[model samples]
Target: MNNKPLAERIRPEKLEDVFGQEHILGRGRILNRILKSGRITNMIFYGPPGVGKTTVANIIANMTNKRFYKLNATNASVKDVKNIIDELDTLFSVDGVLLYLDEIQNFNKKQQQSLLEFIETGKITLIASTTENPYHYIYKAILSRSTIFEFKLLNKSNIIDGLKRAIKIVESELKDKNIKIDEEALEYIANVSNGDLRKALNALEIAIFSTNLDERGIIHIDLNTAYDCTQKKILNFDKFGDNYYDILSAFQKSIRGSDPDAAIHYLARLIKAGDLISICRRLLVTASEDIGLAYPNAISIVKACVDTALQVGLPEARIPLAEATLLLSTAPKSNSVIKAIDAALYDIETKDIGDIPAYLKDAHYFGASKLGRGIGYKYPHDYDNNYIKQQYLPDNIKDVKYYIPGKNKLEEKIKSYINRLKGSEL
Candidate 1:
């Protein structure tokens, strides 16, 4: 009401006032334990936007009774980092200075490295906030020195509670007019904001200012008004961050788990984030790793879809991507090929594999038949069904069964054929 945005005006002043991230902020949680210890360390707070990273840092600074120095890493340089350390060194206090760096991922290697000495020496307690994953964005040396706490997106109930608080603050600020919002309107805002409290509050503030007051000075907000106030919801997805990998993991797992609907949902998330290459690459991996041999042609279809997506590049790319996602999700699933290769590699690394059989050795080279290379190797093309009983593996691992076909139709056929050739059940 005093020209400050609702989000800024209602920022939580204490840990109790903060919402969500209960896994980290609830009693007996890591953060709570750290706060209760009366000593704070250099730490990184990472999460999506509008999830109280900065607010939580401020609360920690206040709760620990430390002098807080805030800097936006986007504009701050290595010199600024060094200067903050210099300034903190001069401060004579038992509670140390808390240097809260926002968008800490923007600090390149040099800038982040500049703070290591100070953090290590206890001259400054670094509280870095980033929307990106610290492990990928921050310097490993700094990561090794700091504790990392991950924040999560606020749920619908959390957003609703925050919106209700915002409404109360607005009504109190505008004492001359009564501002009223329906429950459904709040819920709509919560739903559209996609668990972002800042966006939801901003939308609520817009709705409040845009609506007309009645004769009794009551400004009523409905679902329609809320929808109009908040147009298209902006998704918070950092292509280079944890959300990107998280979505990709979920998408692949959904397809592997044979949940086309969930696969589509995660695919839509990736598409919304405008990550075409990741989608294509993940689809290819899923096709080969999750839907291998069971449907040998699935990889070709996925590859075609990927090529189409790469050529078309979004909007239309989503069509082929969707097709590929559904295809992989519905295709006969098998990890036999991947498992077979992994098992072979594991044995190669962990076991003493004997030399290749003389019959299976490379006889095409200048070695000739003098060494008996390829002497006993039978040409399967001359036999019935183009098959023959022979030891294809090394002498030590001749009986190893690495390729275990799955129970899908195609794999069942393969199992039958292999069983017939081997004259035993596979």
Candidate 2:
């Protein structure tokens, strides 16, 4: 009778047993090469939860003879770190130490800097994991010293494979060949996991134990059982469900359509469903895509609101999310930003753009002047009004218009300023 949760009871012990993350774990990959060399460097793993960050770290520790120490940055402090450092002279630590720090983003600047000396001297091999962007949350000095690897969310097939393995393990534990599962039920659990294999395993375990055995002495699982175990009634994970993406779509469309009432209506529906991540992401995108230069400051406001929503979370998060929705709905709309970027991308893919101007090429290198690089460059600030007309585009596409100002107040003023500078209307 194992008391541990199914996720931990059946955790992958080797890289071959680990699912997904093949980009880093696949044959002949950089991580594989490093592991083969038997020298693990300072590294950072960045990804969402349940994507095998901890599992990979465990595998690395198992492969090496080094002393392994695990600490969660959310709870562990400098004192806990000092405890490990103090043990360096002990008998078992002769092979060096591998410290797997989870949620390393939670460690503040001073706490992170404390590890600089140990990692620099190869006394401790640091494998830090973060759910957030490492470049944004980690110290730059630490980033320069470590290689960062991104873990992607598990696709449906990857999750299904894991679920199948879990079922086999459960059958072996229960010593029963009578456990039966519907294919649809299995997929339902996988779909509702939302790229998280741990969630699917937990849901499957609940569905198996909660259901009563029939007169035939066989346990059966169906869609209803999975739905109940997953609690999808409140947090709809089905992308096609009315309670899921439809509401999210309407929420963004309402904002883009400038209907504050409709936008608020959809926002309330999303908040009720407890989909704060979706609401925050869509709000941030709408603020930039729909609002644009019409109200250039809307992006910063929406960003602050999204940050506040994420920090506070749930019922309290609804306040800032609602504010962002209302602001984007009522704010003037513009598709100019998307249009300009898409147009530029299309030309890059389709056209044969010539080389960059010699003046715009990298000129800091030795003998750049010999190749005519930076020869005719004109400094804008050296001219009147801190402006100077120059040929910025490549020779082939110099006349192509990628940016066209939208007829909004801010953009109109911008167009006027540019027109005055060029002595012509754009």
Candidate 3:
């Protein structure tokens, strides 16, 4: 039996053997065009784990005829990098070097900067792979020198295709024994992998290796055996990673888009990831920012739900979270509140204004009639409807209109009432 792990045992040797990421590696794609031109530039491969970042880097080295050297940034240091740099002057360096740095995000600024000169001068073709966003974690100099390709999560179909390849490799290894994997079992592994090919392959290996052969002299792997190998479905969420932010973004957008299904779907994902705090905070923001004014009561309802969720944490907390998500998603949507506040803030930040109107200025001081304070101020209660058209803004920007009521029923009613008051009393 080969001691190497199944992922390594069946690592794709060629671009055609690689699974997923067709966007980059497919025909006529940018990376594909680069490889076909017989020249590999300095590049950054970024995405989640168990995709084809490292595998494609290896394929590039093999196709380009460049000397391939890999170092994981987690443990590699400046000395290790110097070792590779020293080779650039040797006879073996005639072919050039392709340095594959895995998890390049872990490398500090100085360590990444050490390779700037070599990569800039074409002494080494660097293929830096990171699961984190390269633009955020990688040094700016290194990013400026490389093209970034994002490797997205593999879908279930792509994962199943990879699993089929693994099954063939496993069956070929056991020539004396036949391996029969049920179709349902194959898909079970694919579904539980959460778009990670290597994770699915490992689970499949576990099911095959750990199961006992039936009386038919064949290793029969069923759904039950697959379940045993995969105890829980993979949840691809890092509380501090890009996935967390992406999910939160999608959740809020879904609610704003009035798609309860998508909103609840992302809500469930957040809940499964144990991100109750993010969910609560985002829900409250959505109520005010997205559902404000249209459903003026939504803020109160969502606040109550959030309080309930906090009091009763998950798995029970998902109930009130779901309620809040669905309520905000299905409620009448309006961004008037956020827009109004933001417009006011923009003026405060960028524009100049004159003094406050005397009628609106503080009149409660010791001064009786000094400083033109509270002069000609008509108390609203003294008016017929307890409302009078008055300028509350500074003199310069008093005519600037910031709050444009949304075209919702509540805002429309408020707009009509204000217009009536302006016509009757202005």
Candidate 4:
């Protein structure tokens, strides 16, 4: 009967107890600087759910020797925020105050402006957390006054570690009870959790109840038991916030893995559930990034899918998406473009390959001729345009060809064009 929501019961007390985000909180990081001094400048933590934004906020308050005034932007009135700020004003002489705003994006323009003066003047050390993107929700004026830290969803490995930690906590809590979780069950819980530790632990707790048959001190969680518990399963779109990315990732992996069936399945799910137009737009990105010159039409088809979406509207538009997914998935795969561009970019980042080749430079404008922009530019229109060899690419990549066409039947023509261009001598 002593139920305090297990996640809350085991909420970490100190920074060390927190599971991840070592990048920001670890030694010599900004957080360490803030913690050692107990002086928090205005900061906004942007990320998905259960990624330790709120927990870190609390730890900073505790570590800084500052007064903590918690406010939920969702429920807090303008007066509530003002009162919290006013209280901090009174405490200015005593000690610094950390005003922790949960779901800070819910605060409207006026509400945000009210806190701007305090934040800018260092009258208040504001630590705000938001699941929604602050760039879209938080007012620009207030956002400029604060430092933003992005939090990530717990990765699969991190989730596994967290689950192991949670299991110890769960077992310790039920010291007198006969309850247990097996590896298969843990794996199932971890996979189904989609990177939310709290959800995984809760699901594990439910699974244990549903499967009460213990065998020789080991509580086995059978697939059937898990199935029964999650029979009416639903995607945790709210908690994970991977609606578009989830579908995008699935499609990409499937296309790369060459599983048209899975690609179609995800396509179906996305079309049936959310905005097909957004899905089409992402497919266009993947078609270019992943499919590339292997199937140049992949990008065109994806664009067509988007155009189809915009023109046809939903309900009827899922057809083009399905077609696009099928085409791109079954189409020949190629990341040659990805590989080539990345290599070129790596050189750019690492090397100081000089300016544009003179012939390849612009020649049309007045100052361009004076600047030696197009000293020896080639005019393909004057030639057969077929054999005119020009230095169009960067000198570093002049000989490096990135678009190795795939063996798709239609790509045959593209391959011929590539061959002609590569071997030309105009």
Please report, in order, the local distance difference test score of every candidate based on alpha carbons: 0.88, 0.87, 0.90, 0.72
Q: Per-residue lDDT for 216-284 in model 1, tens only? A: 889999989998999797776777667777889999999999999999999999999898888888998
lDDT of 3 by residue, 305-377 (tens): 9999999888899999999999999999899999999999999889898788888888888884588889988
Worst 10 residues of 4 by lDDT: 231-240
lDDT of 4 by residue, 388-412 (tens): 6677766766766555555556556
What is the Å distance of residue 183 in model 1 from its true position? 2.5
Name the best candidate (by TM-score). Answer: 3
Selected candidate, larger TM-score, 3 vs 4: 3
Clashes of each: 0, 0, 0, 4
Please report, as a residue range, the 10-residue window in candidate 3 with the lowest summed lDDT.
Answer: 417-426
The CA root-mean-square deviation of candidate 3, after full C-alpha superposition on the true structure, stands at 1.6
Error of 4 at 358 (Å): 34
Native-structure RMSD, model 1: 2.7
lDDT of 2 at 226: 81
| Per-model C-alpha RMSD | 2.7, 13.6, 1.6, 9.1
Deviation in Å, model 3, residue 189 alpha carbon? 0.4
Q: Give candidate 2 regions above 4 Å deviation.
A: 233-425
Q: What TM-score goes with each of the models?
A: 0.89, 0.63, 0.97, 0.64
Give the candidates in order of lDDT, highest first: 3, 1, 2, 4
